[model samples]
Each structure stands twice: as structure tokens, then as C-alpha cells.
Target chain A: MSNKVTYTEIVEALSRKTGFSKSKSEEFIKGVIGLAKQDLDENGKAVITNFGSFTVKEVAERQGQNPQTGEPITIPAHKRVNFSAYKPLRERVNAPFAHLETELLEEESGTDEQESEVTPPPKEAEAKKEPVSPSSRKKDNDNSGLMIAALLLLVIVALASGWFLMTADEETPATDQAAIETPQTPEATETMDDVAMEENSEETNTEQVGQADSPQATEPQSDSLPENPETTEQRATGSVDTPETYQVESGEWYWVIAEKVYGESGFWPLLFQANETLEDDPDQLYPSMGLEVPELEGTVATPTSNDYQRLALASTMVSEAYQRAGKTEKAEEYARFAEKWERQSRQ
Target chain B: MTKADVIKQLAEELDLTQEETDQLYDSFVEGMITLLSNNRGFTLPGLGSFHAEVRTEHKSYNPHYQQMMKIPPKKVVHFKQSSVLRDELNEGEDEQ
Candidate 1:
């Protein structure tokens, strides 16, 4: 219950313990406390072995009220003493808990140390890093890989479809009539370009062989010119207020369809929302299915004449891939669709 | 422990005169006071290091005086136990 632990009393105890005169014992105690004070004054802290650590922190100025006068005042910043017991001493203070499992005691001590560190809030800020989403990291590989594979496969299929369509055209003379009535779709436009190129080659070969043959084979070609204006009229009419129907060709995914129609791949949702076949899986577009290519409201943009040709070429190749894969139903349907459009654009 | 008891024990243990020990104790205390007043800290090996520190100026209210006060920046003295001493203190508790 005795509270006072004065410097004089400490000196007396020191003197008695060392069997020294009162003055000598007092002087020893004085020297130690004195050095400690000087250290505190200059360095703001002092350390004593087997005891604890002392630190001095600067307390910032703040507002405070006088208890008696009820008057507000500014409390200026000042030095504050802090004590942290060494690991050994601290463990001793917590000796009662030390009997518990050593790991548990250590864990509790570590948390205490961490909590003490948290007194300065800035340390917490350094602990947190900018969170890059795990999902974003995971998707990087899949996206790039899928894009490259799809493009390579599409190119190979397109070339094959072009060759197939040319051979088919040589056999079917009735295709000339259907070409006049059908509206030029993207697939049709591409088929026509291929057909025209193949015909030029064929014409040269025919000339080489027809040294003895007659020129009557050129008559059907002359008949095909007047039918051109009729198809142009239909393009103009097709560009009017109504939405035109498109026959889905092989290898036509909603993403590509949206890009061809809307000028952006992101518009795939529009195609997915508009079509029934795409309802179950927007990526599962089969060849030869009729799709209502709805006109965008308030905007009257249509795929360019060139776009139709490009799409036709691309889809024709996609169908060829289906043929090679043994899905002949898909290949034939898309071939029929492309042939229909090619004739339509022959005008 | 009391000063008399300490002196008695040291006298017995060292076979030295109490008067001689008291002289040695006095000189050590004087040396410490001189160094500390000048804002220096003393270190004892196997004990710990001692040093002084400074704080910036600040203001505060003195409740006892019932008035606001501007407290100038000042140094404070502190002590830390040496690791050796701390280990000694922690002894039996650390035994597995």
C-alpha cells in the first residue's frame, strides 16, 4: 500500500545492499538515475537490461476544455514517454498465460505487438495492395487462344467452300433463274465473285479447246446482262423501311453475325435476342436457318454491297469445314443458301 | 531490499569494510548525475542502452490550475530491460 518510491529511498536501499555508507549508496543510485535522465533528455529514451524499453513520442497539439472554467483551449503538442517491455520481461508479466500452450501464448503476444503497431494508421495502408481481380487473371489465356484457333479454322474452310460452289454452279443451269429473283445476301455476293473468277478461267480453257467447237455456248452469258438491273432494284428496295430475312450459312456464330450486321462484335446480344435458333446457345448457329435480320430502330444503316460479298466468302468457307467434318447436312444447307444469294447478286 | 540489509549482506559476502564499499558507491552515483544532466545516457553491458529523446512543442489545458496551457516541447527519460536480464526474469516460465 506504500506508494512512494522516491530517489532518496532507492539510494538508501542501494547503499544497504552493497554494505556502503549512506552517502556512497545514495551517490550510486543518483548516478544511475542521473545518467538515465540525461539519456532521456537528449535521446528521449533509455534502456535498462532485463527490464524494458523506453521511448518518447511527440503528441500533436489539440483542442481541450478547462475543467473549472468550461473554457476551450488549445493543447499544444508535447513529448510523451512510452514503455515496451522486452520479450522476456513481457513474457514474465504475462507469466500466468505462459502455462498455456507455447504456440498459443506466442500467437497472442504477436497479436498484441501488432495491435500496438496499429497505433499509427499509416502502417495499415502499406499492408493492403491494389487488388487485381483473380477472374481477370484467369481469363487472359482462354480469350487469346480461342481467337487464334477460330480465325485459322475459318480461313481454311472459306477456301474449300469457294471451290465446292464453283463446281456446283457448272452442273446446275437452273441456278441462273433463281439468281435473278433472290435478294443478294452476304453469302451470295461472295459466291458471285468466286463464280466470276472461275468462269473467266473456264472461258480461257474453253477457247483453247474450241478451235473446232462453235460459239453458241456464249449465248447464255449474253442473256444474263439484262437481268442485272432487276437485282439492283431489289437492293434499293431492300434498303427501304423493311427488315430483310437472312439465311444463316454454316460456321455463322452470333458474334460474327452481329459484327457483319451491326459493325461491332459486341452487338451479338442483338442477334441472340432476335433469333429462335440462337435462343438456346447464341454460339450454335446452324447453316440454312432463316434469321430475321431486323433493322435497327431509328437507324437505317445496311451492310455495304462489299460486306455482303465478304460474308458470303467467309460463310462458304465455314460450310466447307462442316463438309470435311462429315456434317454434310450443315454443308449442303449453307451451300444452298450461298448459291441462292450468289444468283440474286449476279444481276 | 532495505539499505541496512543490503550493506550488511555485501559486507559479509565481500569481506570488505562497509565504509570502503560506501565510498565506491558514492563515486558511481556522482558520475551518473553529471552525465544525465547534460542529456546523455549511460549503458551497462548485459543490461541495456540508455539515451535521450526530444519532442516538439504543444499546448494543453491544466485542470488543476483551471486554465489552458501551452506546453513547450521537452525530453523524457525512459528505461528498457536488457535482454539478458529479461531472459533471467523470464526463466522458469519458459521451460517446456
Candidate 2:
């Protein structure tokens, strides 16, 4: 026999759930049905809420014939019944479909990888992101500052060494004669005269910058040991990466090339000095043109690269301090200097 | 089993006073009647549905009697077993 939950089973289950005696539960079940029947007898319908309806329907009887005799007979009218289940009951009857639907829903969600839908986190969740931007910017500034310092220190050392080398070349023929030799006397006089003229020009420029700023004044004496430490520091910092001579690419300007090599076009003046054969105009252009890029020299009595970086840092510091001190004009002046230094660094 | 047997078993199982179970039973009947009298429906979820429908007067020939006759209209109660109940009843059958 098939297992079925009959009216009796329902009563039993209800009794078990409601703590009712078996007889009483049976009485209750019968009472409810009895009332429904009474209502149906009096009225046309009865509703049991979520369960559905007990409907009374009518039927009309018509004429009928006896199949064997073919005799006509009158048929009496009668009543009929119909039922329609409500939502909950209907859903319960098709409960397995619900499980199928849930499975289909899950499958749809799995297959649709909706990466474009960006659900932002709550504001509190992203609080960490707010402070990060400023901190990252500050760190960037710190890195650029360090790079500037390293580059400046490199340029400074390069300058001091180049100056000392130039001075040594000036004095080499007279004192360091063992380090110099000529197979014949034909070019000796010419070379010595050439060296003398170079020294004279360099000395005149050094003196012209003013007695207070001369190379000799910067040190206790010009011919001293101050240049050695600078040269050692220069070698230690791996300045060999700086190319001494760059082949002039056709159609490229000197300023553009200087900017590429030294990160500043101001150093093109030094290029002119190194490539003495180049025209004074600095803009005369030709293909396959050769130019020399010399490092800075202390004897030039000009501001070194690091001197400029130090000046930049000082300008910004002064600007900020003055701004805090309520000196707007002074602050703006220093800020302009800082901006100029920044521009120079970008050159 | 009979409806009496069901109530008896239910009372025994629930341990409720006879009056309480009887009251519950009375209320259900009263509610169903009140709802149906107003042409509403009653559904015992997972059990089935019950309803009422009107039939109009008509004339028709009865196949058996082989005669034409006038028919009067009437109303009657109806019951339909829920799919779950039907499935339970016909558990071994292949189709619903």
C-alpha cells in the first residue's frame, strides 16, 4: 500500500503538536468539517484561509435514451462540486520545483561574471585610502629630493676634479717634465706656447670673477691638496657614466643636446668652451657636427651644480618659514627662487 | 481510519483537555462556514481545495434514456486532492 497522510493522521499529528487527547482531536477535526459542510449547505462556498475553498456547484440534467430500447426518459437536476487550491497549497504540491528554481538561479549567478559592477566599499572601509594619497605624494617629494642631492654631489666632485686637471695641465710642461716627452723639437715649442696661452686665459677668467671669489681665495692657496678629496669622491660615486664627448646628431641643437646630457641647458656654455672649434654663435648648425661637453671646474669661479641644489632647498625652506611668519612678500620672493631652481633641475 | 479515531488519537497524542480540542475543532468549522457562506474558498494546505460553483438550468438528451428533458440548476460541495496528497495516494504510479 502507498503511504498517505489521511485525515486521521492529520488529527493525530495535530493532537501530538497541540497536546490534545486523541478523541478530542478527532472530535475537533470532525467539528471543523461538519461546520464546513453546514456552511456549504446554507451558502454556495466556504473558504479555509490559506488552504483554498469548498465550492458548491450546480448541475442540470437533460433527456436520456435507453441504449437498448431507444426509449426517451427525463433526467433530474443535480448538484456538483469543484475546488481550486490557493498559492501556498499549490506551491507545496510543487515543492520540488522550488528546489529546481533555486538551482537555476545559482547557475545563472555563477555564469554571469559581472566584473563591471563596481560596488564601492562603505566610507569607513575606505578611510585608509584618504590618508594614503598625501603620504604617497610626500614620499615622492622625498625621493626626488634625494635624487637631486646625489646628482648635485656628483656634479660638485666632477667640477673640482676638472679644475684640478686643468691646473695640472697648465703646470705640467714646466715642473712634471718627466711625464712629458717629444721625439723631436719641432712641435715642442708650439705645444709649450699653446699650453701657456691656455693657462693665461684660464687665469685671467679666474681673476676676472673678482679677488673675493677667486679659486685661490676659496682655498688658502690655489695649488693645494683640496682638489684630491673631491677627485676621490667623484670616482667613488660612479660619475664615469657621464659621457665626456657626445657625437652631434644631425639637426639637433646644442641646447637640446646639453639638456639631454646634463639635465640643464645652462651647461651649454661649458660645451662652447670645450669645443673651441665651434662658432661663437652656438646656433650655427650642420650635420655630423662634433662638440665637446666638459665638466664644471672650480677655477671657473662659477656656481657649482650642488650649489644650485642647496640654493633651491634653502629657497623653499625660507619661503615656508617666511609664510608662517606672516611675511607674504618675502615668502613669495623665496617661492619664486624655489620655482626657478625647480625649473633648472628640469632643464 | 475513521474521523472519530483520528480525533481520539490526536487528543491522546496532544494531551489536551477534551474541551480545548473540541473548541479548536468548532472554530475551524465555524470559520470555514462563515467564509464559504460568503462565496469564499477554503484550502487545507498540502491537503486539497474545496469550493462551490453554480450550475444553470438546461435541456439535454440523456444517452442512456434516449430522450430530451428539462434540467434544473443546483449547487454542490467540491474537493480536489493536492498534488502532494495525490502523489502520496499513487506513490507507485509512474505519472502524476
Candidate 3:
């Protein structure tokens, strides 16, 4: 027996259990989520003991590179929140509702059986009270025969019309071929020749326009090029460029700065690693926090080959443990993890 | 087993018709998808919870070939099973 549970069942069950309207239940759920986020943000941690814990951590500032240009850039400090499941909570979250589904299915089948039994009684009762005449039965049979004949005639007419339309379409293609083979008038030819000449002149005009516009485009290109060169030189001389320095402007959050630098809000941890001098609190960043931008190491940061091997080993271990415990779903999960890590290592 | 097969079994067990089973299954899946897509988690008593987790895009480095490749950010679906289910499955293993 399988218990297949769905969202509707969840919502309906919750509503019924709580004696609340569906909409009210949904609103209550949303409210709980909002409260959870608020609790995490305000208290640094939100713990629902049977469920999980959400914790906000501060990530320090760091130096990263623009992936597109491979040029080194400073990734500023940031804050991020993460969730971790308690053991019992994790188990509950992954549990299948197969038993519940089986129960629901059995209840429905029982009702259906009852309904089927009930349906025959009414039919039997109706049959006991009603009788048909022979003349009326013969008249009904004749009417049905006439209706069948009409339906056949209609089908035949439809087929004939379809055949005619198909033949008409086939005949038109020959005329179309004949039209294509026919020669155009000299006047028409002359017009086409004039159009081609006009197109050639248009192309020449476009080239002239492009040449005239080159100087305007070059002016901005030259200005932008010099700015970069000066900045590059300043960077090479180990001097901080004022324009590139991320000044802690008013109304700035550390997380926001971290997001700008790392191109993701979650990379604040790397930022924290780069700036060890700053306080560890992500929300406590102050103005004029001097951040050191690290030079590019010129190597792509990735999990090592050993990490993949370890992940594979861990997954296999987890699966074996799960199988030994008779946890089919958990075993399957570990199998999926092994496959995923294996593919990642291969890539 | 296929989702439909599971739903069918649920229907049989719950005394529901095939049509009702299908409706329940669809609503459940659609609801979960909607919640997860919105980066929310849903909980069902005696079942498990479904949630979305963010994954960082890591650059792939090959030491042998000396190549670096950029990975992209992704959101993944995560599920956790309930204690009742886990305990039921693991009960026999403790004796062994």
C-alpha cells in the first residue's frame, strides 16, 4: 500500500483540523513564514526544535575578480542566513505519506462500493414500476433505423466533398508551375533592374555614413581607454584608486556591499575570509571600514578532486547504512547523491 | 514506482475512485511545485517537508588538463522524511 499525499490534502487537512477556512489557513501559513524570517533576522537564530534552525551569519569582505574580464575586483563584506535541519526534523521532512494515501484510497473505494450497490436498487425499483408496449417498441426501432440511414448519407456526402476539394487543390499546382515559367514584361524587368541599382547606391551611402560616424565613436572609446590605463597603472603601483575603492556610503548594509562585490549575496563567507581585520558580525559593519582587496591567484576556485572522492565514499556509506536499516527512500537518496557527485567529478 | 501508480494505490487504500486519486495527486504535486518555486518550504504531518535550497555555481578546475570552467547558480529541491516512517523502516535493523 502506498500513501500518496498532495498539497490539496495538506491544505484541506490543515484547514479541517484547525477549523479554519482554506484561505485563512493559507494566510496563517504565510504569517508563520514571515514570523520565522523575522525571528531569524532579529535574534540571529530561529529555532523550531522539532523542525529546524535558521541562523544569520556575517561574512567578511574579500577580493574577487570579474569573471568576464579576469580583472581583480574587491568583494566587500556581507551577511547571509542559512538553515539546518535537526535529526528528527530531517527524518520527518523526508518521510513518504504512502500510508496516509493508502488509508484515503481505501475509504474512497468503500464509498464507491456502497454507491454502486445503492445504484442497482433504484434501477430495480424503477423497472418494477414500468412496462413497455409492443407497438411503441416497434415504432422506436423504426426511428432508430431512419436515424442511422441519415447519418450514413451525411458521412458519404462529406467524403465526396473532401475528395472534390483535394482534386481541385491538385489541379491548381499545374497552373502555378505554368505561371512561374512565363517570362516577365520588359517594363517589369527594367523596374527590377532600377531597384537593384537603388540598393547598390544605398549600400554606398551606408558606408559613407559609417565613415562619418567613426570619429564620434572613437572619441568615447579613447576617453574610456585612458581611464582604464591610469587605473591599471595605479593598481600596478600598489596604490588604491579612489574611484574603485568601495566607500561605505550612508545607508549601506554589509550584505548589500558583499552582494555587489561577490555577484551573489551568499558569497559573504569568502568576503569574510579576505577581510580578517573586520569584526565577524555581518550586520555590524560601520562606515569607512578599510577593506584589503587581494590579488588574483589566477586559479579557478573549485572543490578538489579529493572532495569528489570523499563525497562518493560518504554517499556509498550512507546508502549502505540506509539499506541495512531498511530505509528504501533513504537508500535511494544516497544512490542519487553518489550519482550526482560522480557526474560532478567527471565534469 | 511511477507517481500515478502510487496514487492509484492510495486511491484503492482510501476507497477513492481513480478520478479522485488523480485529482488529489495533481493538486499535491502542483502545490509542492508552487511552494518550492517560490523558495518556500511546506510541511505535512506524518509525511516529510519539501523545500528549496540555493546552490552556488563553482568553477570547475581540472588539475591534469589545467583548465578552469565556470559553474552557474541553481536552486534544488530537498526532502526530509518523518520519524514515524524512519523508525518503522529501521526497527528491524536495530535487532540485527
- Largest lDDT belongs to which candidate? 2
Worst window of 10 by summed lDDT in candidate 1 chain A:
A96-105
TM per prediction = 0.24, 0.24, 0.24
* Candidate no. 3 TM-score: 0.24
* Residue B33 displacement in candidate 3 (angstroms): 0.7
Docking class of 1: incorrect
Q: Give the Å shift of residue B27 in candidate 3.
A: 1.1
lDDT of predicted model 1: 0.42
- The DockQ assigned to candidate 2 is 0.02
| Candidate fnat values, all | 0.01, 0.03, 0.00
Per residue, candidate 3 scores C-alpha lDDT tens digits across A1-347 of 01233555556644533455666445434433444544554576654433456665655677888999999987655445455765543322222110111001122223353334344344443343233223333554578766644543443344344434543444432212112322221222222222223345333433233122223323333333223323332343344211123334345654465455433333333333333221223344443332333322221245555545455655665565456557778678767877776777677
Under CAPRI classification, how is model 2 graded?
incorrect
Question: What would the per-residue lDDT of candidate 1 be over residues A159-221, giving only the tens digit for each residue?
Answer: 345534653554533212222322212233233223233335333333222111112233322
For candidate 2, give the lDDT of residue A214. 25
Error of 1 at A223 (Å): 99
**Chain A TM per candidate, in order of listing:** 0.26, 0.25, 0.23
Candidate 1 TM-score, true structure as reference: 0.24
